[model samples]
Target: MVKKRIAKILSFRYTMMAAILILLAGGLVLLPKYQESEGIPAEQLLSNIISLERYVSTDQISDKLISQDPSFILIDVRSEERYNSYTLPNAINIPLKKLLDKEFESYLNQDQYDVVFFSDDNFYADQAWAICNRLEYKNLHVLKGGINKWFTTIINPKKPNENMSSKAFELYTTRKAASLFYGVVYPDQTKTKSVIKKAPRKIITVKKKKKMPVEGGC
Candidate 1:
């Protein structure tokens, strides 16, 4: 009878232990969700988790170019060969492998520019982003969807959906209308208004003729 009573107590202890473990496991899973629900937006939380300086979408980049925002510096993180084939105009080519090199140290440390990174895929770009973040370089951002997304979205934007809001549809329509009107959908190649240089005036020094009255007297 004593052995049976001891067995019951042991079983109860094991059950309690299991319940405690299950609760811990559940808390572990729900902690993130609960934190998300409490206050901060998920994007901000993710940025903090990844230690990103900022996040930018392809459309935002496109619009920035269209608006001629001069503070942006676009960097292509693809291979040299891939960059040579084609890249966004004015984008400097710095391959992912060489981003950490001393030669690129200045490029990565710029405080005046909003550096945007892109690659054929997000993999290399994200790697570069992480490297820069680890180095504590501020004003860095990743071009969402990378080059592929750039091709699909900014280069050739598609209608979102049939049920998209009228305002959204009108915005898209305006974009299309502007494209047709300007004959240039992308501002990567748009030349800024040029300042005309004025020619310098030529200064002619005329030597005055000395009076010849003294020579005539001689």
Candidate 2:
């Protein structure tokens, strides 16, 4: 059942991409420039719009978080209120509406980390990706199926049947471990109590201190 639902969500990606490409094609000339470059050409943007490489899977994201990899950034494209209520671990909010703000330029334009955008589903995340892609940002991706997929695949993964392939069970085992890392309490982990899921606390932003330039450096 969960697989079916996720499949349905993924199937909509093409339709959404088409609509977004049309909108982008129509408005490309009107887009405002943040950097000196006027952004990528229409043909390149069209190619990017149709490619599947722009999506990063939930499994990949889970693995990165588990390993504490710092080469990637998760951008929650939802509302500020929604973001304050709940979001994936280490995700920072950059509401879809404010994605292009000058304040966030460093986050979106940098080559330091692979930037990922996500929302409840892929709708808004994909929009964020399209916008950034039009601006020719590198290392940008949309979380495939978004947070809903993350909850379904990582937080509370479904167990595979006995008849399922060994590969399936292996994946299930990995997901189980990932779930534990995220603090999910399974029924078996406690006595006489059902599983309890707790939402992580709201995000707290810590600004990094800038380094001072060397006095003698040219």
Candidate 3:
């Protein structure tokens, strides 16, 4: 009888422990859902919690550059050879390998410039941005689509979008109109022709003056 009683007690203890463990496992699964349901937007919550910065698009940057905004310092994070071959105008060539060096800290720490990083692709820029972010440097941004998008947007501007703002459309139209009037659009042909056609010269004859003697008699 005592043996049976002890057996019953052991079974009851095991059942209780199993129930507690199951409840804990169930809570673990439901906790995330519960937190998500508490009116917090997922992305915003994550962003607020993390130390990382966000990405900025090339078109947006091109617009800012066209507007002559001096808010950001553009950094080309490509290899020396690639950087030399081609890069955005006004961008400093500071390859990714040298990003973390102490010699660069002065330029990186300048509060006036929001350091904008770019490369042929995003990988190099992303690495540089990550390094800066880890170092707790503020006002760092990664150029979305990097140099590839820069060429697409700045060098080869596309048609104005239907959803473009009135100001943006006006700016696009103004640029187009200015290109026609200023001959900047068809530069090679128009500018060359204008340079080739010389205006008629006006030659004026000057009267010869009497030569003056030097003060020190030669």
Candidate 4:
């Protein structure tokens, strides 16, 4: 009888211990690793930036333009002067400082256009990305290498060396076709526009290291 009573007590203790363990596990899982105090946390931003999905390449943008992809929405985040000097066809100007304008909320917050942001050197576009990301906006992207890359590759494409791989030749050909379609003559080196390139996956400059780390339709 004593042994039976002891066994019952032992079983009850084991059950209680198991319940406690499960509750602890659940609490830890529910806990947020880092709080999003103001803007997006560095961890989340770093992860998203590293993921190349957040960036669109010049080739991709060009193809979309040639196809007359109405779903694509290009936003030039440079000054009005630069935007006026030369901007993508059908692109809208939205300076970085004015990104949070209430009027733009619908364009950004809506799900219709595949919004792509570009600036001279990816600086302003990245800032815009961070803002839109904080707001949990969807279908937003930064133009990789921005307009500088577009000019170098599509505007006035340099001929690849004979020794270069066929892929290089093919890419240049595609760029040539895109230039013609866009009505841009090659070798327009005098032209300049605010642009940005997608950041490299990692930036190992001394104490910090960001590991290298987007989607589309129509």
Candidate 5:
């Protein structure tokens, strides 16, 4: 069945990610004294790494934005230049290089909001997640397929074929509305320029919290 094939693909992806984890661990070892400690055990880190629960789909993110859900935070892991050019509505720019910076620790190392990290593709975002997960950060998720998938699914969704199921059309309708909500301008027969309303970027004030030990084991 289709589901079985999907499961196999995911299995393969995770297997590859496990290998990447070894390389990441080796790379971290060569970093400065600040990153000397391997925060979590290998087994636990691998368990967390291979889990599919770490991803939030584009549709889910779009729904949260449309509904104005305050429970999640979108962190764009691209550079400042790329972030300024284009990013998801309300996404905060936190470059991959500065992810472990003291100033941004509260945002990533907290249990409050569901922090979602994304980049142009999964590469940078997954690296960010791996680094954080090793440090035992909680409630961290990567945007599935990153900004590229978001643009394809939410910004410029293709119309379903006539023979497609009703669910497909319903999804298309939702995506169309979401695209407008995120300020995607579509061509009109009248040819008048449509005013695009941009959402202001959010600022998070980091509150000092007592540091606690991370406890986990496989």
Candidate 6:
């Protein structure tokens, strides 16, 4: 009888200890972990998103580049291969994958310079912009058309029609000059007729034979 009584007391003690451990674990989960600024407030985050004015035109960027504006910090969000092939002057490459890395957050989470992001198109750059904007980072902007648009406007500019306004002509001339400075090739005004050639067709031979027996003599 005494042995049985001691066994019951030991089992009850273990049960109580288990219950206490479970409660402690739950309490830890309920406690909030800390961070630097606690990020953007919910209400203000919504307001900033709805009121966002986050695009900068290629023409404006070009003007800034020509004037050597120190406030502009162009960010290339494409892969390293693309960035190495071609990128805008004074632009830094921080691939979309690494945008949130600690090494890059200093540049991304600040308002000192006008951060302009660009990719082959607007897609990747827009994504980077969204992340920074969500974090309530200030002075962040996307290159309206990205590098492709830059090529269209500042590189291979088209001449305005004869009836176009002088203002249009003036803009074209500026783009032409910018193209020269950037060492980009302009479309030749002299038209060249394109000759289309057809690829050679391949010949196939068909063979007929008696059906072969199935595997394992099926």
lDDT of 5: 0.88
Cα lDDT of candidate 6 equals 0.83
Candidate 6 stretches greater than 4 Å from native? 1-38, 41-52, 185-218
By descending lDDT, how would the candidates be arranged?
5, 2, 4, 6, 1, 3
Candidate 4 segments exceeding 4 Å error: 1-42, 186-218
lDDT of each: 0.73, 0.87, 0.71, 0.84, 0.88, 0.83
lDDT of 6 by residue, 106-179 (tens): 88887788899999898899889877877778898888888889999998888899999999999999998888
The Cα RMSD in angstroms, rounded to one decimal, for candidate 5 relative to the true structure is 27.7
In model 1, what lDDT does residue 53 have? 44
For model 2, the stretches where C-alpha displacement exceeds 4 angstroms are 1-37, 191-218
Mind giving the per-residue lDDT tens digits that candidate 3 earns over 1-218? 99999998997997899999999999888778755554346665456336444588876676676677888888998988998988776888888888878887877766788888999888888888766765557788889888786655555545589998897787666544433432236556677666656432221222222222443445
lDDT of 4 by residue, 162-217 (tens): 99999999999989878988787645433422122223323335224322221232
The TM-score, computed over Cα atoms with residue i paired to residue i, of candidate 4 is: 0.66
What is the alpha-carbon lDDT of model 2 when measured against the actual structure?
Answer: 0.87
Clashing pairs in 1: none
TM-score for each candidate, following the candidate numbering:
0.56, 0.69, 0.52, 0.66, 0.69, 0.66
CA deviation > 4 Å runs, candidate 1:
1-53, 160-162, 174-218
How many clashing residue pairs are found in candidate 4? 13
Cα displacement (Å) at residue 70, model 2: 0.9
Clashing pairs in 3: none
Deviation of model 6 at 61, angstroms: 0.4
Q: What shift in Å separates residue 20 of candidate 4 from its native position after superposition?
A: 32
